[model samples]
Target: MNREAGMILISTMLMLALLALLVVSQMQTVFLVYKSLNRLVDKHQSFYQLEMIAQKLSSFNNNQLQAACLVTEKNPDEVFTLLKNGKACSLSYEQQSFFYLIEELGFFPCMQTVKEKGIYSTQHWRLTVLAKDERFNFLQLRIARIAPFIRCEKKPLVFIHTGIISWRYLVR
Candidate 1:
């Protein structure tokens, strides 16, 4: 009877040790999952912010869009503050940030017959967008666009032109 009691106590201690280890491992897995989810949330927020900016840019006129692109080209690392309600908007708690660059890509002649009488010019632009969160997890996109505008006109009519995205893709 004494031997049986001793065996039972030892078995109980081993079982308790195994249970503790299992619980510890489960807690670690939970922590890892939580961290991954948190990162995913941050990335989604950054992507949403970037999408908003892209949508706004798409709506902008040629001059406004070009100006913004030039600013990005001048300083690639520039953190542009968005304007809201006539004021500069601040970043959210997730520290989501994004910037875009526009490069002059070679333009192809849309019309074969281009005489001196033709007054319209088509320009292609290569746009690169980079978005990041606080953790530096970044998303990159490349867009090719064609913008047609009148270079010079005698009339006072101000013709507005919007760029059309020819090709776009995620870089990384």
Candidate 2:
């Protein structure tokens, strides 16, 4: 009887030890999952913020964008620099900050008659948007496709001879 009682106690202790280890392992897994979810949420928030900034920047007339293109530096990282005319291109939405560059990709000849509405050659531009938030930093830089504009005049109207080619998101 004594031997049987001793064996049962040892078995019970081993079982309890295994249960404790399992509980600990489960706890570690739960913590890891929680951290990953938190990071995902932050990234989601930042993505939307960047999109909003890009839209706002792209929603401007060519003259406005041209004026805002004060920073002539081709490097995107140089956007953070304090420039003599940087404020023209800088934007603040809610709690986020943004900077955009309007680079003239190239120009193509228009097929339309040069007489109708004075339609001339078309120009392509790239609007590169950079956003930062004190609360949620941007996950990636957004490139907004403004349009391939058929220049109507030197004033550079936004929609007189323009159409949205496409708006695709680039992530990296």
Backbone N/Cα/C clashes per model: 0, 0
Model 2 residue runs over 4 Å out of place are 66-88, 110-121, 133-172
The CA lDDT at 10 in model 1 is 100
- Global lDDT of model 1: 0.48
Worst 10 residues of 2 by lDDT: 136-145
Error of 1 at 5 (Å): 0.2
Q: Give the total clashing residue pairs for model 1.
A: 0
Q: Residue 100 of model 2: what lDDT?
A: 58
**lDDT value, residue 124 of candidate 1:** 49
Candidate 1: worst 10 consecutive residues by lDDT? 81-90
Pairs in steric clash, model 1: none
Candidate 1 deviant stretches above 4 angstroms: 65-68, 71-97, 110-122, 132-172
| Candidate 2 TM-score versus the reference | 0.62
